[model samples]
Target: EAGVVQSPRYKIIEKKQPVAFWCNPISGHNTLYWYRQNLGQGPELLIRYENEEAVDDSQLPKDRFSAERLKGVDSTLKIQPAELGDSAVYLCASSFGRGRSNNEQFFGPGTRLTVL
Candidate 1:
């Protein structure tokens, strides 16, 4: 019944540096997603995983961003050579199923990254 958990609620780094965020989803959830929310905007899906497989990642920035859910439980998102525009809240969510009808995602307190 616990919600997803994310680490390092806030981070600040210089541009061109590297940073990483971590997430641990609910115990029974099988699907995980990473999202990014800019100021005054809704969360945008960056990548999605069903178990250890990455099922949807079209929106992810392959050049600088990467994600992985190794054991289908906890996940990590990383951004290398971070840019100033990369400052945003990175959210982690999970759901019990992949089907839209039964998928009710639980979100974690996002990690707010500030690229200076």
Candidate 2:
């Protein structure tokens, strides 16, 4: 089985600029999640998708952040007009079940965004 994949492991952008990240979940996994980890902080769920439907997205900042999982196999997160405070690690995780517990999630290394 393949592990999760992400591109541009690091990014640097000016405030108010736009940035985007990509992720490809593990094969056969039915649940995918996007999380944000501020420096020295644990990951906070940004959005979660079960198959094709977005099960959770309340934590996402609609003002400048957006995400999508078109085929339920891969996802992308975009930040338009990025803010300096948006600098953080964007992680993509996947699981076999949709439960909110340990072991279910296998996290990617994360895309580290540095807003200047």
Candidate 3:
């Protein structure tokens, strides 16, 4: 019955350091997603997980960014050797998988990352 949950609502790190964020989707939700929001831009989908499989991740930066959803539940996103450009709000969202009439996504308060 709980909404999505995310941790460390704010994070600050020097450039080139590594940063990680976590999220727990709503119970019974079959889909989860990770998104990045740069200042003045709308959130862009980084990855989408249907159950435990990553159904889409073309926008994710494989060079320094990675993510995983374990056992089809909680998920984590990591950015290694962070860059100043990587500073943004990392949002997590969930919803019932596609094919349903009411598959509206529910979003969590994003983890704000600052690269100094």
Candidate 4:
């Protein structure tokens, strides 16, 4: 089955540089999510969107991270002045809706970023 698709499976950049990751969700899915996973930790939610509106982004670092979902299909996550601590796997996920019973999300392969 076709699932969420993400580009640039890996990225390497300087600490102060900027980086971006893209994601394309499954057809007809209306909710999307961005997550960050460190070396030994589980994926942490960075942002969540219901269509084009960001319904949950409290965990996102507003000073350095920004995300957008255009036309509610494809989404992009960007990080400016990427810090060494920002080196992690960026994951993208999508689901049919945000209801409690319909929250099962399909995840992408993820973009692994390495900041030096």
Candidate 5:
């Protein structure tokens, strides 16, 4: 079937503006994840969802970043009052099962956000 889908492939906004991203995972996948990747660095997990429940989100900056997965299918991530330091690639990935050791995650093209 299809891989993950994300919208607004690219976005440019001034500092303090609000930005949101959308994601649709492959059918039959039970796990979803959101990650932020900085230039020259690997992706960092922002949140992980097992079904509609958020199982891991310790790394998410609750002050400005928030995410949700409804009915265990699609998800959305939002950043309010964006900061220059928040500019990065936001990725959405999905897999068949929970945890990272057993399954392979399929990633979307990602939404590149730029804050000026």
Candidate 6:
């Protein structure tokens, strides 16, 4: 099966500008996730999806960030009025199951969004 895929791989925008990123999870995977990676840091969960349901999203920055998994398949994450501090890699990951023993997720290369 194909692995997760992301677009642009990189982006640059000014503060207060709008930016959007796209993601496609692995085939047959029922769980998808979006994570934020700050420089020199591990990925932090932003949101998670179990098919069409958002099973976890407590860490999303509601003030300027938003995300959705349309049709429970492909997902998109957007940041309206981006801030300079938002500059980081936005990673998309997917997993075969949500069970504790099957929790390892496959990750995309990520979209490096830089708000200048």
Extract clashing residue pairs from model 5.
Answer: none
lDDT of model 3, residue 105: 95
Candidate with the larger TM-score of 5 and 6: 5
Between candidates 3 and 5, the one scoring higher on lDDT is 5
What lDDT does model 6 reach? 0.91
> Which residue pairs clash within candidate 3?
none
Per-residue alpha-carbon lDDT of candidate 4 for residues 14-74, written as tens digits (9 for 90 to 100): 9999999999998898999999999999999999989998999999999999999978889
CA displacement after TM-score superposition, residue 112 of candidate 6 (Å): 0.5
- Which ranges of candidate 3 are over 4 A from the true structure? 99-102
Candidate 3 TM-score, true structure as reference: 0.94
Compared with the true structure, the alpha-carbon lDDT of candidate 3 equals 0.92
Q: 1-116, model 6: which lDDT tens digit per residue?
A: 67999997999999999999999999988899999999999999999999988888899998989898879899999999899999999999999887442688999999999988
The CA lDDT at 78 in model 6 is: 92
Best by lDDT: 1
Q: After superposition, how far is residue 6 of candidate 1 from its true place, in Å?
A: 0.2
* lDDT (Cα, tens digit) per residue for candidate 3, span 1-116: 78999988999999999999999999988899999999989999999899888888899999999999879999999999899999999999999866432579999999999999
- Backbone steric clashes in candidate 3, count: 0
Go through the candidates in order and give each one's C-alpha lDDT: 0.94, 0.91, 0.92, 0.93, 0.94, 0.91
lDDT by residue for model 5 over 9-83, one digit each (tens)?
999999999999999998999999999999889999999999999999999999999999878899999999899
TM-score of each: 0.96, 0.94, 0.94, 0.95, 0.96, 0.94
> Residue 116 deviation, candidate 5, in Å?
0.7
- Comparing 1 with 3 on TM-score, the higher-scoring candidate is 1
